[model samples]
Target: MKKKLIQYSDGYLNRVPILQFILVTLLFPLWGAAASLNEILITQFKVVFELSDFATAFVQSAFYGGYFLIAIPAATVIKKTSYRVAIIIGLLLYIIGCYLFFPASNMATYGMFLVAIFGIAIGLSFLETSANTYATMLGPKESATRRINLSQLFNPIGNIVGIILGKYFVFTDGASLESQLAGMTPAEAEVFSQEMLQRTLVPYQFILIILLVVLLMFLFVKFPKTKPETSKNVKNKVNLGETLKYLSKNNPFKKGILAQFIYMALQTTVWSFTIRLALEINPNINERFASNFMIYSFVAFFVGRLIANVLMTKFKPTFVLTIYGIIGVAALTYTAFVPNMTAVYGAIFVSVLFGPCWPTIYGRTLETVDDKYRETAGAILVMAIIGGAVGPVVQGFFSDMFGSLQLSFIIPMLFFLYLAIYFLSENKNDSHVKEESKIA
Candidate 1:
């Protein structure tokens, strides 16, 4: 099975220009890192700005709000132009957003920082729409899910590194800096807070330089002008209204959208508040210590993705998704009720279960939709990432009201339950369609 999967990957790689493939794959981790940094931002901003839990979660709202607002526009851009142009546009916006952090810090306003994050997220929306849809076009239908999963393997790797970056530079240093200011006068503490806020500027500046280089690479790289897999009937002028009309008949695709919506919501809620849950449940854990645990969670997430990659070659992608979703529901349900260190570990375990859900569902959605509509479909699903914007704030509100971070996990538990149902229903509907076609 493993050999066959490798052969499939190699076959696709052989078909595409190797450098173009490599360049596209490089984007997997970049956006993953950018998204994962929000975890640290949630924790850091809460402390740095003295924000309430609800207010701090606005970071996610602003970040994913960009996705909500910009995904369709990005789709329109890709529809009118080419994926390469869209990728270059995404990279430029990402770089601009990263650079904006410097001015935001200098201004010492949280709202300014949110504007920066929003800009960065718009870039991510474009990249996801282009890259994910492009990945599906690289291989035959049978292996599309595995191909995306293989590319997505780097996402967790980048997440692990992002967590590490947050640990060493943002969370740890901020904690130490805060401790230093505890003994100082209010004036001195204010000065120290400004200095600490400035620490964020360095990492984003480095990110800006890296994105600029990637942008240049994309500018010069030659991507395949068309894929054999894309339907020749696909018009350059894709009509959004017509696409929606077609999609209304696509039952599996609709379910896939729901699953993606809930999946993203659960993912952002669990991760965005992990540090808060950790400190609340575990007496020995501080903010810095909990940040390390977040890294550990990503380690589990990476391992889960690796295992899922292997499992995809052996079993159906939907089967794997269903299994993971079931486990995730159980674990998150346990986490919500337990309210202890065990629950903390359970939350991490559930995160591992979520690792494969994103890529698998995305791959399956592309497979089910017509090639003509895949790009627009991808954008609509990325727009569903607004669930990330919505879920965290809801969870934050619950946590603030109830004063129990652990119990607030009920929000994500419900999300996982929705996913398990969607997965089963999608598979059942597919089987029914196949059976009816065979009879005909």
Candidate 2:
């Protein structure tokens, strides 16, 4: 079964979807591990570069900006290149992003930091576009959501661990580090900041080393590379018209994408606003509290992903999505309007509903298209991450306009409301009930 998974091009892959899910899942934790990185990075940029809070936030905006621009192109690369090669390219890009920090710190330029984040986001975009589609391929069409959800378990778990490590080692606040940077001349600041960020090189180098070993293993490893189905219900050829036509014609597909777009939009808004909300409660929030929030957010992500993995085995992803969406609406509303940490924690629960939806939606897109169009479907699915860039920026804009961070979350709340409606409608039809991932 494991051997079959490594070679998914052949029909034999369907024989062991779980193993396929498992193997691709190896990439999921890296997703979570990267979560806290944004918050830590933004904070660090402000202190070392002596930039305003808004400027530091814009650095994050730049990363998402790069993510938006790079996603479709990366997807195109994946379609043309093999998944294995694409994964390697993504890792190389990630390494370059990390390495750039050395030079960026040396320059002590906020712009350089943004450039590095941009590089990292681009790499992540590539990784996601390729890996998500690969994960969906690991199961039956009807059960694809469950399979993808199971595959995403490690992403959140990785996120939790990453938050802790990033907090402790990457950008944890220190009067010493802060004072050291302050005392340095611009050139000295550059040197000091570079020195501090250079510490991240150790982790990045370790990852590179591990991946090198893994690459050698891949050389020895035999994974299947099956061609998409020739006689699929849809044509083998993919063009703009066909992609658009397919999406327009399929009700479930159209509904799925709508929900996906909005869901992503909402998720981005929540996280973006969470930072302000945290600061509002305590004006003097240091690196320590921010790290805690990162950890808390990751915990929510972990619980959410883990829950989806388990429930996918027993309940439909559609059902799970609906319940979570409604609950998410409640959570977001309370987080925005309610005034206490207890109420704010409700927002955290929203992560549970959210964590599983991205993969679930993409899995649905797979069902909407013929196997021949899997690559395109994957591209569109991942392209939806542009919502991360767009939604957060919009939230930030509204926060600036409204002079209140809490109100900006309304955007995500509304998006989830639409998703909730779609889920309810689908569940009522009972037309697409399917098997789920059982490894949970």
Candidate 3:
């Protein structure tokens, strides 16, 4: 008799739905481009609005604040509905937010631009909450970390594209906008400000078109139903009180939340200040030239992610993460104490070290979580992204208080140090658990 074949419901052998996984992975870069573009906006807005460093930092504050506020609601949406539906909702919010940029530019209102950014972030929050959790569910639990890291590999591609867009389109190559505004008559300055604001909108307009195409793709694609969606139990409703209590007891998840928060803060603060630091260190370069360093940083980030993907397959994710974290702390320490062009390079190289920290923390955190609580756990993790909002502002404050941008590098250095230690401790805990299990 011929051997019988086993049938899988979701996909081949119930393995990863390759096409669906690709589509979901694409979401990483989309949000990444948006996030990195904010770095350019920070530089542009500071000059255009004649704002202080602290004021300019509000750009990130508004953007990530949206993530913090909407994360739980987004998780709830995923629990109640499906990841596809939540992603569609996210895309819609992203589209709406992109559209608002036009009106914001036309009105020449900074506040309106912030509102637009917040809307985009809300969309991003939903996408991140859903896409991240969904990616983990795409394969076996054992490979989840590697799988999420693979998806995140595309993120730096988006970051690179974003920086390139800003470098070429958003930033002007000439006398600084501040200098140009100083030379203009009052009426000319108002007209010029409007013109510059409109120019800044160009990249967003392009991104909007891309978002629309992706949205359509997402709308048409049939995603595999994962555990959360496949369940028929009525008890799946997300109870914030109970969920919080459960997650609170999970030591790894709690620590992961804290680590994610610090990682975001470090990432945002580092990128936001990259151009500023370059300009400060190399006073002759324009913003356009300064942006090249940011691009280099993004490239380093991409390379680091690729390397981490390989490394994680061979070593424990926590062990690899610990090493990366140590190197990041060392790099940033050099960056803080030594305010030279080489130090700036050190700051740029830190991006490579940072590449794996987020996904590693995220994947490891969720590993300890029950499948039933995964969506809520993922949402809370995304909410930790509020660190992005808070970090830059804190760095800006330090820069303003001390009248030294380089000294502000100390903040991220300390943050990196904490990550190194946190993961080191986690490694010890994992070993202990394994020993206990073996003994039993």
Candidate 4:
């Protein structure tokens, strides 16, 4: 069949970019299942199992934990297969993860819950690896920046729906604590708490069904073709050893990847503890309702990326990433020191600042690389994202023995301090105006 091509705003973005957009958009609901499911999962732990902030972060640790196990294997699969095949495999694993939650929740075993989440995250690992590569290959190679930005809409959109669903399910917010305290016995209050947390099933099952349907839909969808050169052609196309040599010598790229990895660790660590931190902020804060606030926190991420897309046209991507890294330092500081719900809420807005870091940091890293190695470079980038898994786990361990989840966030913040240095070096010696003009 002849492929239907649609042109994008940038001249290079023409030809079926819409298909990529549609596929990327699916990330919303997939991630939504993750984000939304998190609220109830964590809340139930805190109420039933009486978990600490450190212990609670384990929930996210379990999720990102899959990335570590699956990262390399998923990349190998992608290298061997087409993007569509990899994605299909990923979505299938995710559905299994979702269904696993049924038995976990039914058994009321925290271990089971973690196992299920790990399964889902494994699926996500494949999705992350494939979808990003697909997006990059979709349009004019020169217009890669524009295409990546446009594709990122899925990130925040999924987060938004995830927030809403997470909040709606976990937060049973009826009868203020004061009112309940005045009327009910201690035993009665505990029962109410149990009932409130169990309500998570309402949304978890709903999204799980949506994920199943979506997975089936993608199976039918005709994703555009993208293939890595195979066998004899592979040697002629690109050599992995040479690609590694090129990436290794690239100082800015090396530092940038390290910076990005650290930045993500810090970001994930703080966010994993966000729910507990919100409650710490307001004694009256509903643990169930905390997911709703998280929804608001994620808005900054969405809005920040959207704004960056517009401003990237005017500003250099590296400069933008550097500024965001610096702002990330400031936001982490604010989040660390502040005790108010409003301050924590404001701190989440930093996601906007951070929203551009991963992609832009990546773009800057590859700025020096020849485009032939882009696929290999992408696998390395996914490894960089694995820092998210590692960093959060470290923070969670701290939270486990320590009393403060907020304070644990500082550990990851240290990584961002290094990221600032990486950004600073990206455009040294040259005038900022000249750099922007050159890229423009």
Q: Report backbone clashes per prediction.
A: 0, 10, 0, 5
Clashing pairs in 3: none
List TM-score per model, in order. Answer: 0.90, 0.82, 0.94, 0.84
Tens digits of per-residue lDDT for model 4, 1-440: 65556433221234545655676667644764575456446655765655665566677777877866786677667666667787889888887887886677566666777888888888888887777767766776676666666666567677677667666665657643334545878798767655654554566577667777777777887765554334445544656687788888877667767876786686676566677677666767665566666676677777888888887899866667668778778777777767666667655776777677776766656555655566667667766766766776787777665767666667766777777777677656236657788999
Which regions of candidate 1 deviate over 4 angstroms?
A: 1-14, 173-184, 227-238, 433-440
Instruction: Give the clashing residue pairs of candidate 1, or none.
Output: none
Candidate 2, superposed: residue stretches over 4 Å from native: 1-12, 17-21, 46-60, 139-143, 173-216, 231-235, 239-241, 248-251, 273-276, 431-440
| Candidate 3 per-residue lDDT over residues 1-440, each given as its tens digit | 43333223331224677788999999999999999999999998988888878888999999999999999999889877788999999999988988888899888878999999999999999999999988887766667777888999999999999899999988888877777888999999989888888887888888988898999999898876575433455665457788899999998788889999999999999999989888888777788988899999999999998888888779887898899888898899899888689988998999999889888889888888876778889999999999999999999999998898888999999899998999999888889989999999
By lDDT, the best candidate is 3
The TM-score between candidate 2 and the true structure equals 0.82
Give the whole-model CA lDDT for all candidates, comma-separated: 0.79, 0.65, 0.87, 0.68
* Among all candidates shown, the one with the greatest TM-score: 3
Question: How would the candidate models be sorted by lDDT, starting from the highest?
Answer: 3, 1, 4, 2
Which 10 consecutive positions of candidate 3 have the poorest summed lDDT?
4-13
